[model samples]
Target: MFFNHWYKLVGMEALNLLESFIQSAETGSFSAAARRLGLTPAAVSKNVARLERHLGLRLFHRSTRRLTLTTGGEQFFTQVSDPYSALRDAFAGAAQDAGKPAGVLKVSMALAFGREYLVPLLGEFLALYPGIVPDWHFENRPTDLIRDGFDAAIGGGIELTEGVVARELAHTHVVAVASPAYMKGRPLPRHPSDLAAFDGIVRRSGATGRLRAWTLRNQVGEQAAAGHRARLIFDDPEAMAHAAMHGLGIALLPMPHAAPRLESGALMRLLPGWYADNGPISLYYPSRTLLPPRTRVFVEFVVDAFRTKGLARRFDGR
Candidate 1:
């Protein structure tokens, strides 16, 4: 009875600071955690210190150059993050039973995919599960689920990382698309080599803005040459699609993102014979022993939604 009552009266500040401390530990920088929360470095430091004092244990060994979690800090953070996350999920489930999903479900999603595909689906999901609220972080940059506290993310080319669990929610194909105006009687590329002549929209490297190699695969599964370069470049896929739509150049984009334009004949698939890794899009979360019922329900909802929609279809079939 005392335990039940105590859980109910737990203050938000303690939990918020705990979450902040976890982020600071993961990123190894108070300033980074501050930036994420829109707080100053001093504020983040103070909050963590407060939480540490409350627990009567030093959570981090701070220095001017680096912040490392102390042995106790490491154990405390690791042990607490799961229950804290679960507590939040449980509260949300209770709210849902009364007719709403009431917690912040942090999610990271690709810019283009989020905008063109996921955005449309949210309204329907909210209508069905009004208690759940999503705090969506849209970016072209790759997300680190552990460091970032995201409940789930939808991304292409996901490499299975340690301490993370992923479901292959869907698979999709990449298409080389260009605007009709961009084509303007220009000779079409017959092969990947001919792509050299055309301007290309590209994904930027994580460390630097340098263009990344686009890998293409053929029907026989022979990997195409790995180093196709781009002339024009963009970091965000949506920007690349927009640029391609405005007659800037060719783009290898996810089929769903390019669907409306292609269907309207505003953009056309170039070199249909060639194929590339449409990388399996996945829903990833922290590999935990106990996933809360709310998260389980939402994950199932999302996976079912994608599967039901036939999300992996390629352009050739259309």
Candidate 2:
């Protein structure tokens, strides 16, 4: 029994060494693996070296700039990557069964949506799950949920990838809005085509570097237009809203972003019946068979919050 126990201990150490090597290979550097694994660079390198010795194969081509995996290493990585990920997730799920949600919950979200809808609820979420730390980034651009190590992300129109799933948090609608001051003497747009006559506040896509066109639909049908006479252009939704509020021009904005200003009488919805269907705002995460408790609970919390506040339908302009 003592010999068996010793053998098992050695096997476990070998697994750790393999794990370190895998991290190094995946991150392309021992230093990056060390940061991820909370180990020193020298320690990670030592572990990888030990792994290479045990296998009797050089695993990486080390250079001043970066580490590249050897042919043998690449083959081994392909075999182990999926199983390693599954094992780690299983262990994490088991750890999370301790009855209280804990650890870091990293989230990426759109800035305007987070500020208007998500930020205010975080105080209550922390109050409820004090053990969970919220590590959140609010940006306008899409993020790689897995590569970036995010627990989850919230955004609209996120392209679904293999091994990732999205839960619909709410549907978002877009509307044309302008400050009442800006339209004080200007004739209200009687039709979608009339928007061409006004100065427009446009939003450019950060990822594509293209100006987003305004697409509106009503009982009649869909009408698409690009604002060529842009009075102001911004990549951020908040900045566009502010510019519209300052009477810069007519801005096509998301309902949630414009809702507050509209309520305060700073901005008025143009062609109220005509609006754009952007898509659902979704919470995206890896589709693990057993989700971590922190991620599961946060997803539940956000869904409940939107339901309780009647935001899901309201955001859709219902």
RMSD of each: 4.9, 3.9
lDDT of 2 by residue, 57-152 (tens): 788999988999988878777876777777677656665424677888889998778888899998999888888889888887767775555789
Write model 1 residue lDDT over 50-161, tens digit each, in one string. 7776677788988998899999888787777767768655654565546544555678888767887678778877777676777899887778776665677788665567
**CA deviation > 4 Å runs, candidate 2:** 1-19, 27-47, 50-57, 63-66, 78-83, 96-98, 220-228
Superposition error at 19 for model 2 (Å)? 4.3
Best by TM-score: 2
**lDDT, residue 240, model 1:** 76
TM-score of each predicted structure versus truth = 0.74, 0.83
